[model samples]
Target: MSILANPLYRPLFEILRSARNGIVYGGKLRFSHALVINLLYKSGPLLPRMKSVFEATKDHAQVLASFAIIYKIAVHFLQSDAVLGRKNLRLTKFLAGCFGSWIVYSGHFNLFNGGITHQITLYCFSRVLLALGKILLDKYLVCFQPSFINYQGDTMLYKNLNGHQQRKLKNLIYNKSWKYFAIITWGLVMFVYDYKPQYLQSSLRHSMTYIYDVEMDTWDTWREFLGI
Candidate 1:
């Protein structure tokens, strides 16, 4: 049976699909059209507000990633019945994921000086709003129906498949090796862009320098920006 046919898993699958779509599409826009618009066209009354919003949400990438990972782990445990008898496991998992991600990411990659009180408050509030929105939508939306597949008795995919094959299939889908490689490659690319902004198109370099206030000609500003 297909995983999407299972009611219990369908919502989670949809959520994951939506997340992946947003990451791909939104990332492309950020690097291309959005970057150009923000740099060149964003001005007048709206520019300050836009900048403020960007600053507030600048360090939220790690927090969002942490939330996704934790949410997946929590769903896994819930589906496997690992925490069937445990009370508050869901809450604990959520808190741990949020706080742990924030602490690790902020400590290592924090670029701003002074305190992070505002950032922490904003992150927590954003999470709360997201949870509330999801709950409301799930409750009111009639489009999501239970999967026709029998998720309790047979495996999600290829019910007749052997245990080893099922495990292999699961591993193929959930393996982290490729994800790590992608992350490393992305990090290296970002490092290059930051280290040598001049390598990019002149317009983009100027825009980036303007927004980030980085002096690409010298190491002193870069070091200071990195808090080294």
Candidate 2:
């Protein structure tokens, strides 16, 4: 089922639809927020990876544009919540901001570290994006309504999470998921770093190889410098 078809997400969909209609008929300049939302809905899987491209291409303007769109969406969600008193709206705005910030940070970092293979940056950026999703789901269900999850033999949306299963799911989403993503990103970063020497040695004229070498070296040194 489409996310909007689910009762749990119907409210959010209504709000977004209303906002979309408002822009279409109310003559409001909502393109900024609309762009982000459009990309999110239409390119859900690729949304995170696209940020890497923006960064690698040094498209700061596009990155900022995307952020601006997300910012507008945040404001819209907040205002809607204030008017409609849907508590989830507040959390939704919080999620958007958190996700938006992480995306911007990841994109900017990837762009600045553009000396490496875009694939490496793409992988890291995707992890960051996925981390944001996990954070949203964790924060919403754990903090807002720990009892809203269902964990019996058959899974269904909007069911309450039992005590035993709650702890397990919470640990899985909040801790284990993040830990796994971090480890994978670390491995990829290290791989790029170790291969940098070989890649640059073969193609000295390849500026990106050099960039990768420098970026990876700097990251390694920083990690050791901080003893992390």
Candidate 3:
């Protein structure tokens, strides 16, 4: 049987679908934000690697334009449920994982600088928040309705749960909203730091500098210290 057709695998499929959608949406937003920074501020000093890419290439504008097109194509591909079969789904998941790994590696290597690091961190945290929000929304807001239970294929799924059990589930999901709020607040703080690092207090700036040493400082110093 198809994965979605099997009751045992349906929940997994739903979770994967939600996660993929969140990632694609988050990535698209990040790319668009980068495009704006590249065009308007020229990546500024905050994102040194992006500035280097623009400076080192003669056709950097064309390259960025191509990247925008590619981002749109990726978003479309990820969103299209009708065209994605099981094999395609697995392949896409593998590709997404590889892309995520590359993003982490690039941040560590200072490929884009501290701003990129901040953006990557926030993007990841936000995606997780979004996935959890989707799950909770489906369970509490969508699935709790009598109409939803009636229309669902397996009546036993909801039939086994009493009112108290359903209320408990809703309460559990509702209580997790604080996590989503925290992620959003953290993302905003990162955004401010990316735009105006000097606005941060001296101690906080020092701590952030230490934390993002690879991205915020020169790699040559680290190499010299290591005697490489």
Q: TM-score winner among the candidates?
A: 3
lDDT of 1 by residue, 1-228 (tens): 877799888767855764565445434433454445655555567667566445434433334434455555554555454555346666756655655455443455453322333444444765676566555544433244222233466434344445675456445533454466558866875686779866654444566566666555455487776545
Query: What is the clash tally of candidate 3?
Result: 0
Candidate 2 segments whose C-alpha is farther than 4 A from its true place: 1-128, 131-160, 163-168, 197-228
- Residue 179 Cα positional deviation in candidate 3, in Å, after optimal superposition: 7.9
> Over 4 Å off in model 1, which ranges?
7-15, 21-38, 41-66, 78-81, 84-90, 99-228
TM-score of each: 0.29, 0.26, 0.30
What's the count of clashing pairs in each model shown? 2, 6, 0
Models ranked on TM-score = 3, 1, 2
* Candidate 2: tens digits of C-alpha lDDT, residues 1-228: 877579978655655665455334322232343345345434456766555444433433344444445555664565574654456766666666676656554545463233333333454678779868877986787556634334355653333655676667767667776788789967875576566645532323244443443544544487785545
- For each candidate, C-alpha RMSD in Å? 19.9, 17.4, 16.1
- Tens digits of per-residue lDDT for model 3, 2-98: 7569997765555555555544654565556555645654434656756544443323232223333444344445646765644576666555554
Candidate 3, lDDT over the whole model = 0.54
lDDT of 1 at 157: 34
Candidate 1 matches the true fold with a TM-score of 0.29
Candidate 1, residue 27: the lDDT equals 42
Deviation of model 2 at 83, angstroms:
23
Predicted structure 1: clash tally: 2
